[model samples]
Target: MFGGGGGGGRKPLDYEELNENVKKVQYAVRGELYLRASELQKEGKKIIFTNVGNPHALGQKPLTFPRQVVALCQAPFLLDDPNVGLIFPADAIARAKHYLAMAPGGLGAYSDSRGIPGIRKEVAEFIERRDGYPSDPELIYLTDGASKGVMQMLNTIIRNERDGILVPVPQYPLYSAAISLFGGSLVPYYLEEEANWGLDFVNLRQTVASARSKGITVRAMVIINPGNPTGQCLSEGNIKELLKFCFHENLVLLADEVYQQNIYQDERPFISARKVLFDMGPPMSREVQLVSFHTVSKGYWGECGQRGGYFEMTNLPPKTVDEIYKVASIALSPNVPGQIFMGLMVNPPKPGDISYLKFSAESKSILESLRRRARLMTDGFNSCRNVVCNFTEGAMYSFPQIRLPPKAIDAAKRAGKAADVFYCLKLLEATGISTVPGSGFGQKEGVFHLRTTILPAEEDMPAIMTSFKKFNDTFMDQYDGYSRIIQYYITPSVKT
Candidate 1:
């Protein structure tokens, strides 16, 4: 009854014709608001992209030593130039020569699918140093960025539609998007907002049981340490508990530790899950499979454009690792420059090296500025009428919870938008500050929040805070009696 080209006209591919799993995905970091921001910018509007953790776009400078080394590597002939010493440090020149020797056919050529062997060795050393445990260069699959490695791992893990990955509520949407794209069900476990977005095992257990009841086979769990969006650093005790839970449940652990170097608090230090698991020793370490991801895009490096990152696999079967390698080979190799950056990231200028002083200064300045901006933004959000923000102890974002009035909720419902989306859009219109809605990252049914990067330059924070407060105050005032109710609910009256 159906004709190829005779039924009026052939439809190219509507929503119904596309892959259902692909259609289910949504990435709000560069979603509608960002597009609109771009348009406004073209029309002469000054837009600050707060939706994503892109430090260089916000004026954070890249470090000198890494750039110099990469530059020389890209063009080795520069080393032969008489003025090379004036432009690059002696150590940087030596480093470039060292890496160039490691490269198979220079920067223009494709590398081994697993990555340049020498770089992988450096990554292993970096990990060994960080975790105080041995790491295998063989297990490292260098990709375009941490994202590629994450997607590959998920693709390898997800069997079918019934397979699921336990993702954190208010998680980075990459996990959800990757799960959807790979045809895996996302089982969300809500992080405790009252306890500064800490992981609650009770909630986790409930989520797993619920998914199981619904006939969903949870294969793995994704934990974002020094979390994305919510920005909570998991404690060592919590990490141990998570490992135990995964071990007992026969689940793999996917640790998104890209923000490992972004910790701002003295009290909460970043601990690799590998370190914790190995510390547990014996059967626990042997039994649990972990894939931890890291990137140069976040932290002080902020080399997002370079797209350099790596993921290390621990306790995965050799066959499975081989399969991952096969999948990686399908793409030939990740960009050689990115691979080079990954190598340089793990092994930067050391003590007494020619570039060490400048490297240290550049790195420190960027990190300290981020800390200051985070505190300023957190304070600004807390000062708002119906807003409550947890401290950004780690990571580059502040996920602030906003209490919207019934009227605003109804308006959002009418407009067919999430409550936080409505608020964020209005904020964008009033002031050119673009942020992602909490619903973009999963959240509870009635809760409303927004994720804004604490990444605007330190000097610009005061102006951003002023504009942010002004907009929120005016917006809250429009919705009558909302602030009073939130204040009452949050701080219950003491009846003497």
Candidate 2:
């Protein structure tokens, strides 16, 4: 006897075909790092997180005015309460009204596709003062953070299969991920590691030419000043030459200046590409289109959770500017609180303001501490026998070139792994220090390196370094076979 429903007519759903685009992308490193960290936690190990540049996780605190503004913005009704006003700084209240007035739709309503005009104007002023050039407010588009601005810029230019973007081989993975996710070709250029991780113009020319020859329309070149994972800040001459190259090649310039405030060396002050472009005078034509990005996530703020940032597109055609706005419009607007935070960030307390003295002192103290941390970490790394670290001239990372023993290299090969990655994994296992391998950021074919944040608390750094050195020596001794192979690989490649 057949049941009431004799047969089922429905077919199984194929979830595989639902997201073919997502399937094409792989963020394996991040996933693996997370999984490994979780496993170690379960084992009751103390894990040192250095894989990402997050300061708050490392004990760096935020400043006053910004947080106060955040509290007000989060609870707007506070604006009406006299008690609330007393609790809040007068400057904070004034700033809120200024933001509301400048807000495209008065903070209560939706803003323009670009952003609130007043904030943009403040951003413009900030740019002018920082870059030493005149900036147009209309060209600025505030976003959730530099990441959104970057993705939008990438989306705007990456039209079809033929379009491509030139990015440094050892780059912030965001560029590679965005280009791939958007279905655009990625043209890789090598950074000269031997010469302090400098940009190689020859490699840039060769990469662009190769892409163009292959029918790929090279659209833009990305320059991460105070580079991520590498920590090399470009010189003024380098910036000028790069700008010239961009103009000659007819490519849009994408300057990731998020770490603009993190420079440690006096020689390498964060030089604005806007300044370089404008300073070139009439021959430079001011016609070269450029997009400069900034974020509150870096510098002294460390408000990564807030995700407040903006990007300015200078010297672009009016039509292109509108197109960018249209794209941003689709996302409605960045978080409202984030927008207010960004406004305060760019136009922070000035002298004579009630909170100026306290705010300025607190901000400077935070920066001073970071400076100390950077120096301490760099000095400690350099003291190790087998690790060679570049100066932490700018940015908060120290990318050290580690000399692995022959045994370790052989063990890694036997286990079928990149030597640096193998070393990092073992380091993580032995001690809870988490770091990203150079391979993840694209190193030279044979050289092995690792990127670690110099952000652990100052007092704990010495102990961390000691633990790292001990682990390296033990790992090398344990893997003698791998060390031999690594030596052979390096011998021929070694210069001098």
Candidate 3:
């Protein structure tokens, strides 16, 4: 009627006409709570954005050398300016010149779909040094970010509705989202939250068996070391068990190691899945397929927006790798500048380099600050009347379980929200602090949690925790039968 082709018909891409799978994707990190917080911010409310693991957004300064190298590579014309030497450190300039030489068209050019060969080689060397095993540059796929690599692998693995991937409960939500997007089943294996979110082989075996009983072919299993949200590092023993499980189950292992550099505890230092696999020797190492992912987004680099990441594939057949290459080639290329940033991340300044002292100092300061913040957040949560938090051994998040009483659960029902969601909304409204509800990340029945980042400024963390406590105390009193009485009934918190 309005001179359109369909004459008052519904929009060509109507809601109901959209892909069913698209409608099923749920990423709680930026779900209702984040949206509400954003709306509040728009209305002039001061809101602390901690719903996701984005560090740079919370005022993390980019490392000097990376920015320098990326900037130089982005504008290689500066190298010929002669005065460029005055502005950039010699090492950064030299590194920029090296990458520029590798990429003839520079950052603006579409690199090889597998990423710049030179950068892939750099990543391989980084992996070799990291895992004590050889990495083939041909197997390294530099992604726009680690997330893109994840989706790509998911795409490659999930062939039909019958194919399933074993994902951890209390996952990052990326796996669930991707599985839905690709129209595959997400078979959940619950991590023992009480065990500091450790993997349970019995749980794994049962979950895989259950999936099989339902005719779901379990294709792969994802392991996030120094886990997201939960933030507990996997012990090397856990990895060994996981590899054995994968070998016996004939499942591929997808290791998300984005937070390898973010460990906060010496007792639970980060261990790579590949390292454990190889250390276990022949059949398991030689037979179990593995893909390990890493990114510059989460570490001290905090280059979230920089989109620099790579995943190294081990034991994948040549044809399958070729098919993945074809899928990547469809995108033409990964982000060029991102690849450069990743190169700098894997190969930063050495002790003798001019930028070494400053790089080391900046990285150290950020890490130490995170360490302190993790401690403060954990202790602060444990001190709360109706809250229990395991130590954030690594990663940038602390996912604390909220001990909501029956009355609070009923109140949440009345509010048309999950108990944790209602509590998070209340916390946000009361304290102007934003967080992701536990329901967003899958949790066991009767459990409720909220994930908050430890990325706030160190000085501000104490005040933030204090504010959270004040609001939580009042919230518990108003809904959870008053803290004093509730405390008597509640079990003593566990210390891991």
- lDDT of each residue in 431-480, candidate 1, tens digit only: 99999999899888888899999998889999998999999888878866
lDDT (0 to 1) per candidate: 0.89, 0.80, 0.90
Q: By descending TM-score, how would the candidates be arranged?
A: 3, 1, 2
Candidate 1 global TM-score: 0.96
Report residue 468 deviation for candidate 3 (angstroms): 0.3
Q: Model 1 Cα RMSD, Å? A: 2.7
Instruction: Please report the TM-score between candidate 2 and the true structure.
Output: 0.91
What lDDT tens digits, residue by residue, belong to model 2 across residues 303-377?
888877899887789898888878788988777667777888888999999889988998888777778878777
- Residue 105 CA displacement from its true place in model 3, Å: 0.6
Q: What TM-score would every model get versus the actual structure?
A: 0.96, 0.91, 0.96
Per-candidate clash tally: 0, 15, 0
Give the residue spans of candidate 3 off by over 4 A: 1-5, 480-496
